[model samples]
Target: MARIKPQALLNQSKKKKGPSRISISTIVVCNLVVAVVVLSLVTTYRHWSQRSRNTLETQSQSHRFEDTNAASEQKSYDLPGYADINTSKGLITVELFKDASPEAVDRFLDLCQKDHFKGMPFHRVIKNYLVQAGHSQSSIPVEEWTSKGKLRGRLNTSPKHEAFMLGTPKTKGNNNKDFELLITTAPIPDLNDQLIVFGRVLKGEDVVQEIEEVDTDEHYQPKSQIGIISVILKREL
Candidate 1:
């Protein structure tokens, strides 16, 4: 049991406490550094995420606006230059030769727009010749069409011959006053100058053939009723 010096013992205790303090200080500094690094990383991630979300939202809004504008433009566009004749059999679309016969086209379009052709039967249908319609006397009996003197009065007795030529001005004699529309089933060169050829059948030629095949009397009047339901006129943009 040797006795230790007091100063030595005090020095030893001081050395032990110094190492403990150094260790504690080092641990506290390391923890602070780690906390600061973690906080910086979290802030950077939050900022990047916010920016990415905003960019996505902007892109989505731009696409929606473009689609809406395109749809609006499409809705505003007008139909192509054509007339739709909806008949009992099917729809017949005709493309008018505006350059060839402007007046005839105008008169026909006027009748169509006024709904004058609706419910009017194809009064005269001649197989391999022509199909005649637009007669106001459609509801009347076949004999009355000519016997009542209505047909005699409505005849274009002296139609303008110049009307057959392209770019010819419309004359009072060549106007469609009787509202008679003739669709030639075959190439009848003799009728070229007599009847107003404003439009040609673009679609539904089969329907024309069907109408021509219908049973008819000696007066060329359709035995079975065949009428136009409606007419839709469309102008090209």
Candidate 2:
């Protein structure tokens, strides 16, 4: 074999070096692309996880709030007695406490048994408060007379205004009478002693208020007739 020339040897060396340069550049570019892709995937996964957790927390908090509010408005009783009064305004239902005020409740039941309140007008009403009527012929007071049928004692008298007595509770020495109407509210001082507080308007207080708001004459008669078509009470045997 002839001795290899120096220029030929140099040319062979250049050819070998070209492949190494291309391989090194390719390796560096591939590593950079891989690093960028990995960082992007990590960022996206973290964002998605945080959003999911936030949504779950919000829904849980909303449910807790609604549960608390609903419980606050709910009312129930141990005794099982109810009165449903149908009036021109609408239906006004009441759940009474017979065990708490037995005598007064009995009096009310007696009147209901007699059909006493049928077709009676709601004689009185106060806004956001009560509508009252039970002025039957029997409720009218009898005048006093002597044994000879002559006017005796005071000579002239009026029916005892016991309508308010039912709205009142028992005092230090008195028992509350029965057969009247009342509704509850934030509580009032005058009502503390005078009203028997037989029952509350469980629903349809808006109708009560509507009756109260109607224009009244000097005697407190509503301009529009608001009457009790019927009164019903039910008790479990």
Question: Please, what is the TM-score per model?
Answer: 0.50, 0.46
lDDT of 1: 0.66
**Model 2: worst 10 consecutive residues (lDDT sum):** 137-146
Candidate 2 clashes: the total is: 7
lDDT of 2 by residue, 1-237 (tens): 899999999999999888544588899999999999999999999999999999999988988888776664342233346777788878777666575665566666666778766787766554433455644321211221002234223243221121222243343442223344544322333333355555555666666666667887765457777787887886542
Candidate 2 Cα outliers beyond 4 Å, as residue runs:
1-80, 136-178, 184-186
Give candidate 1 misplaced runs (Cα > 4 Å).
1-80, 136-177
- List, residue by residue over 118-152, the lDDT tens digit for candidate 1: 88788887676667776543333444323434343
Backbone clashes in candidate 1 total 0
lDDT of 2: 0.57
